[model samples]
Target: MRVSLCVLLPFVFFAQTAQYTKDIEVVKVGVIFFNNELELVRAFDTAIRDINELELDVRLEPLKHFVSEDDSLTLQEFACELIDNGVAAIFGPSAKASSDIVEVICNTTGIPHLQFDWHEENFYIHTRNHKLTVNVAPAENMLATAFLDILHMKQLDWKSFTIVYENSRSLGRMELIFGWRQVHKAGIKLWHFNRGDDYRILWKLVSSTREKNVVLDCPADIITEVLNASIYYNMTGQFNQWFLTSLDTHTSTIRSLNSRQFIAKMVAVRVRAYMPPPVHDEADVF
Candidate 1:
């Protein structure tokens, strides 16, 4: 998959106004992240390395800070520190609360801010004045429409289906799907899963409902637990069709959770266009 940073960085630097110096210099780019976002940090580092290889006059340096997503004061401090250190742009703190704090600071300081988190369309409409901020997440309605298209192509008899989502934020991603349910008068059921909840109990309830079509929207970290619970409940059979909304669903960890039987019945959407490498002969599929 093409890392968004790889594409966005060039535009960010080249679009600078005449007020900024045209002379070659080392440009510092700030990154704000949570503790669990090491993968994102690694990706950011890789992107910076790849960009530097172009041998452009402007060299790029990354300044990253790890902060608690809920710590508004600390996040604000970090943002100010990055700006004080002369960063041209800031990326992430993908969680909504922290992102808002950083975005406000960046806006006031006239520094560019970029995000990779999903947000409702109205957010952009309301924050039109914050022209320095850019979000690369796909629009909710667009993603919902894509999901509908995929369902249609699969030709599944999904008159009724259960939507199992991770949190309140995930609900925003489902708005268009909810509208579709209303329009079609489909029997749609909703289930919410929090991090500490018993996965077995959740899957048991779902299994008891005998719902053949299920849509799961959750972070990649918990997918294995969720699927393991479903498997324990015999919910991974050919008759059950699962659609996973996480882009990381195609990762090796997730793919390893599927046997041939499970693979045939499950569908996962990812950002990349490429298909996964074929399962190996000796490797355990489950």
Candidate 2:
């Protein structure tokens, strides 16, 4: 699960080997990301060390820019600064709106912009001309296909399931699933719920529905809350089955639900493993 990454942050250096032992070129790259996700920063740091050890002709000099979720102006300002400094590429501003602004700058400036996130909208798939934007996240179409395969593997009649999702991102995933209905042959029902303190209303609707098959596409925290409500509403029983869209479900432990030994069929998607970029030693570079 601890995969090395370079796509999350903008790394815009040419991958060329040095012509001679004396030639050394250090290319500057900019990484714009949220202040949170310190874990990603730490993981990227290790990736940097590995890259540096490669001793490629074009060494990477990373310039990090951290921004808040609400500050669109600051995100633009950071992109401007990175451009002014002649950075080869710009990495993030992980929020969708901010990322749009950053991508415009990258395209206009002819710099490659790398991004990593669950791209449900297909915004980062490709461009008509510049092709500057790149997303490292798995494509929504691929994920949709994988889910269908999972359903078939389980030999479950998942065609009549209800989709319980949280927020716009989850809805986007739901759309991906529905868009591929010709292949899946599933008549899916959708329910959208915002993240909040109370899930009683949502639970009531879910419990009242005749469909015992449920597909959940939400954050881990929201998943926990929904499962709690499912139990309270007496919705977890022999006739029901829950299919989780999140890869991290196996890692999640709902003690209350587990203690009751609710035996309704349950299954989850496993997260896709990420591979780090390849690194080469000085000799290999030449």
Highest TM-score model number: 1
Q: How close is candidate 1 to the true structure, as a TM-score?
A: 0.83
Q: Candidate 2: misplaced stretches above 4 Å?
A: 1-22, 25-27, 49-60, 120-130, 175-187, 247-257, 271-286
Candidate 1 backbone collisions, by pair = none
**Model 2 residue 61 lDDT score:** 82
Per-residue CA lDDT of candidate 2, range 1-286, in tens? 1225443333323563235433658777788778886756776667766777874666778899888877888988999999899887776655344346787778888888876556446443345433787766656767777776666653575657788877656554455556645422346777778778478788788777676888877766457777877776666788888888875565466444765547677777654434344653211210
Q: Residues 101-208, candidate 1: write the lDDT tens digits.
A: 777787888998877766545566337545677776666777877777666653565778898888767776676667667532457788888987899899888888
Candidate No. with top lDDT:
1
List RMSD in Å for every model shown: 5.3, 7.4
User: Clashes in candidate 2: how many?
Assistant: 1
